[model samples]
Target: MSLSAAITGMGVVICGPKEIPDATGNTLSAISMAAQEAGIDLREIDGLLINQNELIADDHLTLDLSRRGAFGTLKVLYELESKGTTMSVLLKQATEIVNAGEADNVVVVFADAAISPNAPSGAAFASMGGDTGYRGLERAGGMLGAVAAYALIAQHYFVERNADIDDLFAVAQAQRSWAVENPLAWIREPLTREKYDAAPLVAAPLRRLDCARPVSGAAAFIVSKPNSSNSLNPVYVRGMAQRHTMRRRHAPHSPWRPVGASEVFTDALKQARTTADAIDNLQIYDAFTIVPLVMMEELGVVGPGEAGSFIAAGNTRHGGSLPVNTGGGQISGFYLQGATPLIEAVTQLRGQGGNRQIADASTSMVVSVGGRLESVNALVMGVQQ
Candidate 1:
């Protein structure tokens, strides 16, 4: 539905592979950075939303988040953790609160330090309850985490389409090209096919390069009523929708099963009075190399079993008809959960994309596929002229 809110400014702090002092502090600083751009002081923020991902990063403060931050008396405050979809959910909730006049100048922030020196490699997500779900069916799968999970989907997808596995690396290579141009991207080096093959295997089909590089990063966004005097060239929310297509604890019938992606895509675009083809850019929350294809196939952007060929044909690279993850996405860029795509889209729309900016691009469609691909959230945004 059309939202009567606009994003006024945003802030991001990306650190190296090590932990920074009070990772939560990074998030707070990001808020200050964003609020400054919005022409608002810390005391002016009446609402605050923070995505506390305990599973990914143990650095987040619990209820004491607001007390320890640089915010004022918050009329609305919540610390949400809904896997990766938390960013959009926070944004949507902030918009509603602003539009309803419950609060003004709300800021949503997210910070993570999953792959630090303190935490073992992949320790943050190693405890994920594999695809067996709540049923606990004896699949001999336990603590397989996300890489193994997506590998399962890739195995099914590639086998079904008889698609070459090299296409997966092609996506990594394509995203790396964009990352090469992104100053904030962690992996700026080109991902050659040889390097991909040489990379250590995370799962059967996924290599180290195929997975998102977890890093210590934080991002914050400020939103207020549409066209407020304090706002400047604000980004208006065109449409937003979210759907959870999963049982509470049941595993999907198929690994590549379509999660309510089409529903969110259709509803959000319809509310925006636009179509998928009209979208100038796509910012997909891609945690793995195969996610883009799964999303494209599920969204009907390309025919079933055809998304691989589409990307391998350079359809998603810069200067193509459609640029998916033009800012390198989470796979090649640093993984800050849903904040990766959300902030990237905002950066592009603000005409600050630097070398990776898409020319004449005014509209962006961001999709956050969360959980075990169970929750799908789609949002359409347009930059006000």
Candidate 2:
């Protein structure tokens, strides 16, 4: 018999300082508290998974006081330590542990502290790979260079398709408008096309406002048996799929690239037997505005390169036909290591997303990327009746 798991609890800690100033501690505390509030005791948790830019010092020291205090007695089924490792890998590990019955309940936590590398402003982008060499270093380069590459892609998208710059500015304006209503968002101020156009460029064709925030925060969730009484009313993980790029990282340029996000999304829809029209909401990762723009095309929501026009039409706004990033997304919402978007998707499915809630939301989709666009993972979540 196959065992199923569902998220029973969740917690968030953003824009604050804490006793455990390190990212790992803050993340653990956030999810622990959420799980406790949802009725899981810290001592009762059998499995723990943590994701951060750096390893927790406590996890290393033989006589570390914090390690003993935090996870000394628990049977840690899985432990991952890497920076810029995709959230999909983390999610996959946790799911396997739960499926194996190695633990009855699992806690997944992700956090990142304020990261300002010693490298020059644009040069620090290379740090995404942590301290590894070669593949890791290349991955880091991809992270840092993403802004530049995305700008190039966005520019090409517009020029080849005859899209006006105003269309892109309009997307920024619409996202900001939604952020204004979200109190937890890092940037809640209303934005204007004039101001957006005037903002200094981070990269040619990409302004500062068009880029996502570099803020630090943490988020967590508790996964347990689907039938557990502690589970939320609905919001079960129904389908998931992950795909990697066929092209190797060494290849500087390849016309036939691997990691097709569109393919993963379509596979997820197939597993869930859902169609674009059946999806009630979406939470595509917006590391940069261009990411979502590409997703819009791949997801078949709109024609290729037409995401700017589609977004400008107001279909993605709160009251629009399809609501996205109700929590302002990484663009406006606090950047919490990419896990927050998953939390938001769960909130919407449970009908508990206050203020930003979409009316009668029954199903939602989540898309996340890792490395220099080498991997894509998509999940289809819905109310479990």
Candidate 3:
């Protein structure tokens, strides 16, 4: 496949809950690290793109702060925002900028300091809508938070597919298996089915292990022309597509159906001029176990309602036919929204995944969904040889 843009560099920063760095600190550090890996001078980075977490203060994370704190001047700068769809969208923007000759190198960074002591993630998530008027109504109806919202989706999926708790357990177990190999993973201990089954329920049908634990950290990647000699490893972007299914219009008819994912994944593959068979690894935004499970089926590589069983059969673990979320995914890894998936893909594509690396993983597919599946995006990438 012809490459449009490729990730040349990447960096990560982990901060403890008490020492949470503001968006600027995280962004500057991560971007500087990425720039060095790309073999480019900091001043040569002409573009800066920031993906601020929904929970962070917008005023605190501005392009002005990023520029003043790091790169003095840039050809392009912008702060991208969304609940979970920011990663792929930011990448697409960076690709467009480079491909159009607007900039030679664009650093995409996601910096978040939302983690707070004794704060419930659900409560913080509820505030992301900017206190929109609908928030009151949603909360009044016992929607509670994202966890509760996803639990409803999980319930619908279970009934439709005849799946039980064991299916969810498999997803969590496989992720933990990978996490044990990831030094950055927050929880790397083996996950027993017994423990998964007995974990305290955060939302009905969704246990504590099912949801991604929020962490304070930053991740950044440098995007540039594919196969640039400046990079030790260049993970090229092959295809990209996005879709937004109006939930109000489709929820009543197909609340449980992942129709949007099917469309987006297919379009992405078409854009890459490749078949699904070429995708050897996946780095999907798995905020919850069922999220990727449903995506596996919706992507059509796995049969409908069979993703749970597919995972249970050990097809997604390391050394399996299609190792998924090789960095343990968001469920086991720290939750950084879309960056969680992209980071793993870049590492594995660069042959830097270490113990969790998939064997000869040349191509990887990435998927990110936003707001209870209201919006979705997919990207196909290949390791530049």
Candidate 4:
């Protein structure tokens, strides 16, 4: 008894390193924006799902957001932590709960204090998995952090496909070009190929520009029936799919092929009753520059070993065959995981992307990768015809 759902309201607030230090306050403000856009009182929201991994603090925020008034006695409130793909999972879960008549509207919120001074570095993630023997294995090989681990993958991708590192420059610069037009984007300074090439190396093949910057920010949205909202334009959630590789070390390595994206993308498109050609825009998880390069190949946007060449040719840039990460993405934008990308997708669909908006854009695809490519999730979204 799966139910159909649409995004009726969305809110986003991004603070820079010097701006503010309130993650909870930003999240509440975002939630208020969404409630305002949906033209619904806070009391009308019956379901609330917060992605715990993206939050900087306690589980009390959910209650705080819910206690404003009398919620539907059938309210649903919970915290979820699924790494980078938590937002998509929550979307699917909220839709199911709403369809079951247990809740009429579901509010999903995500906020992160990644940019906080005390936050751990990206290198830290690479070690947390050490408990599973990966640390010892990596230590034995002198590979210490996420940058080191992914650098190994990038090296493999280059050798196996005979690709050059310059291709990554193309990917980074393209996203930066889009970021320049995005006011909310963190990295707005022009990122040139020359600048990228000369950037300091974090690992052998991975440079400072290859990784996403952890920034404090918050984003939220409301999921409800299309007819139940006050908004004139609603983006329907056509389809979704999630898959995981479990142990990435055992997975095959390839540039044009992703670990689990093919299966997930295929299932999502099939469920949406659409094809790759129908998508006018793509909001890929660019946690790192290499993520989108491999995803483009996995989604069949380019042939095997053709991603580097395809990107270098500027086929994925704005005003090209396919525009991606129109809002700069995780690398150039704040790293709020999938939450930021999801908000950008909604912006594109709503025609609110003033400068970076795709012309006549109606359909968009969002893909989120987590756990060093071990987890993949995709969503097919479109405006109601």
Best by TM-score: 3
Give candidate 1's root-mean-square deviation (CA, Å): 3.0
Span of ten consecutive residues with least summed lDDT in model 2: 56-65
Residue 251 CA displacement from its true place in model 2, Å: 11
Rank the candidate models, highest TM-score first. 3, 1, 4, 2
TM-score of each: 0.92, 0.83, 0.93, 0.89
Minimal lDDT window, size 10, model 4: 54-63
Could you give candidate 1's per-residue lDDT for residues 1-385 as a string of tens digits?
5446788978899886665535677888898888878888888888888887755535664567678776678999888887788888888788778888999889888887676666755776676543455523423545367787788878888887787678798789889989999999988998888888999998878888889887777898998864444545678677888887764434645656656788889999998888777898999999998888888888888888888888888989988878989889988888889999988888888788888988877899999988668888898988742
Order of candidate numbers by lDDT, starting with the best: 1, 3, 4, 2
User: For candidate 2, what is the total of clashing residue pairs?
Assistant: 4
Q: Residue 325: error of model 2 in Å?
A: 1.4
- In candidate 4, which residue pairs get closer than 3 Å at backbone N, Cα or C atoms, i.e. clash? none
Q: Could you tell me the TM-score of candidate 1?
A: 0.92
Model 3 TM-score (2 dp): 0.93
Instruction: State the lDDT of candidate 3 residue by residue for 94-134, as single tens digits.
Output: 98889898998898888776566656544455555554477
Candidate 4 lDDT tens digits, 84-183: 8889888878877766777877888887655444544453344444533766787678676566767776777778767767778888888898888888
Model 2 residue 366 CA deviation (Å) reads: 0.5
